[model samples]
Target: MATTFIWPFIILQCVTVVVIVLFLRMFLHRQLEIGMGRIKRMDKENLEKEVELNDRLEKLNEEYDMKIQNAEKQADSLINMAKETAKKMRDSERVKAKEEAKRIIASALQEKEKVLSEATRMVNSKAVDFSILILERVFSEDELSGLRHRVTKEVTGVLFGSDNVGELIRKNKDIEVVTADKLTAPDRKYILKMIEKQAKGKVNVKFVVDKSILGGLILKIGGSMIDGGIAYRVNKAVLELREEI
Candidate 1:
């Protein structure tokens, strides 16, 4: 009877221990599964947060790149504008300089022309005066007398050699002769005879004395004049000198 009782007690004790051990194992496994689930949920949340943060960083980077590109473009535009402005300014200055230079050159040329004109006028006047003085000094009184006679003879010859001497004398009806000195009675007679021969009739003869002729004869036939005077010769020389100058 004692042995039977002891065996039943021992079997009951072992069954209880096994039940406790199995209960402990199931509880620990449930707790472990809950911890594992919480860890997985935390990992998913962290991964989602990391992905959102990466997206934000990418957006910020893109905005920054756009801003940088815009800044670069603006800088380039400003540089180009400055260059264009500088080029325009340079061109304007060049044009102004050229115009100024042209104006100076034109002014200089005008001044040169003015000076030349004044100088030419002065030279011509002096040349004329000098020429007249030289002529007056060169001829003596005796030489002048001879020159006057020769000149009068030449005038008579020229008048006689004309194609229509008689017609010219008749149309004019008055022949004016200019001399530096009064003629002798014989010289007057000779001149009057020559005039009548050319006129083929009686003609009026007018003799004018002008010492300014220097010593020569001037014959006026109609509206024409034949000048063979020292003064006139000097004037012709002055005119030629002016042309040469």
Candidate 2:
């Protein structure tokens, strides 16, 4: 009876330990599955936030590119304007320089012309003075001799001539003989005797001996000069020729 009762109690204890072990294993497995699901949900949320940040970065890059393009366009316009302004300034300066040079040249030419004109006038005046001196030198003693000869011939004609002079003198009592030469002893005796036969004391004789006269008897009874010298006649002819021009 004791051996049979001990064997039955041992078998019941082994079954109870097996049942406890199986229940513990199921509980631990369920707890592990719930932890893994929570980790997966958190990872999904992080990926969504990352996508939004990437999109913002792309928008910022596009704005930066647009700003850079605007800056380049503005720079190009400024450079072109500067170049045009510089070109206009250079052209204006060139024109101003050319006009200044022309004015300077014209002033120099005017001064030169004035100097030349003054020099020419001085040279002409000197030449005229020289010509006058030459003319005076050329007309020497021969000129005087020619003058006397012409005067004598004119005087003789006036006293007694074949032309109308003789008739003119006989009609006028104012036709008295007037002489500038001195009456010598022999010359006065003959003239006095001839005057007594014609008009007494009416013929007045004035006397003078000018070497410049070149020897001539000048008689002026009327408002006329009777030129008898060669010089006076020749000089008158030359004067007439000169007047023709």
Candidate 3:
């Protein structure tokens, strides 16, 4: 009886232990599944964040490249503007120099005229008794006219060369021709034809009648001035004489 009772207790203990073991195993498996599900959710959120960050970085890079291109274009424009400004400044300086030279020539001519007038007055005072009536009567009007013509030809050639004037006419279409008198019809036509050939279009030629240039013509185009006139030649000659003195 004792042995049979002992075996029945042992069997009951074994059955309880087996039930407890199965319950514990099921609880642990559920807990592990819950943990694995949370881990997967966290991993998905991290991946989404990474994708969004990559997209933002890509946009920023594109923006940066666009900005760089715009900056480069602006820089190039600025550089070109600077170059144009510098060229304009240089051309302006050259124009100023030419004007200064003209002024110097004018001053020298005035001084020479003053000296010549003084000398003439001195000679007239010294020769109070002498008379030019005989010589004035001897030279006929026609002879005096011929002498004036010869002097005019030499003066015109020395002051203004046809070749240089022609080249200037061809190069500058928008020209300002300053002269003591109005141009003749044939002269105007010749000038227009010469300029039109180089311009390939209608030339804008402006005529200015200024007696101050004395005779011949003075041409002004853009920043350039061609001083081809009687007044300029006389002034230049006076300047050379003053320099030598």
lDDT of 1 by residue, 130-187 (tens): 8656655897767767877787677667766676766677788878888888988888
Please list the C-alpha lDDT of all candidates, in the order they appear: 0.81, 0.57, 0.68
In the range 102-148, model 2's lDDT, one tens digit per residue, is 99999999989988878755655454445445645776656634544
- Please rank every candidate by TM-score, starting with the best: 1, 3, 2
Clashes (candidate 1): 0
Model 2, position 152: C-alpha lDDT score: 47
Q: What local lDDT does model 2 show for residue 158?
A: 43
The 10-residue segment of model 1 with minimum total lDDT is: 127-136
Ranking by lDDT: 1, 3, 2
Judging by lDDT, tell me the better candidate of 1 and 3: 1
Clash count, one per candidate? 0, 15, 0
For candidate 2, the per-residue lDDT at 181 reads: 42
TM-scores, all models, native as reference: 0.47, 0.38, 0.44
Of models 1 and 2, which has the larger lDDT? 1
How many backbone collisions does model 3 have?
0
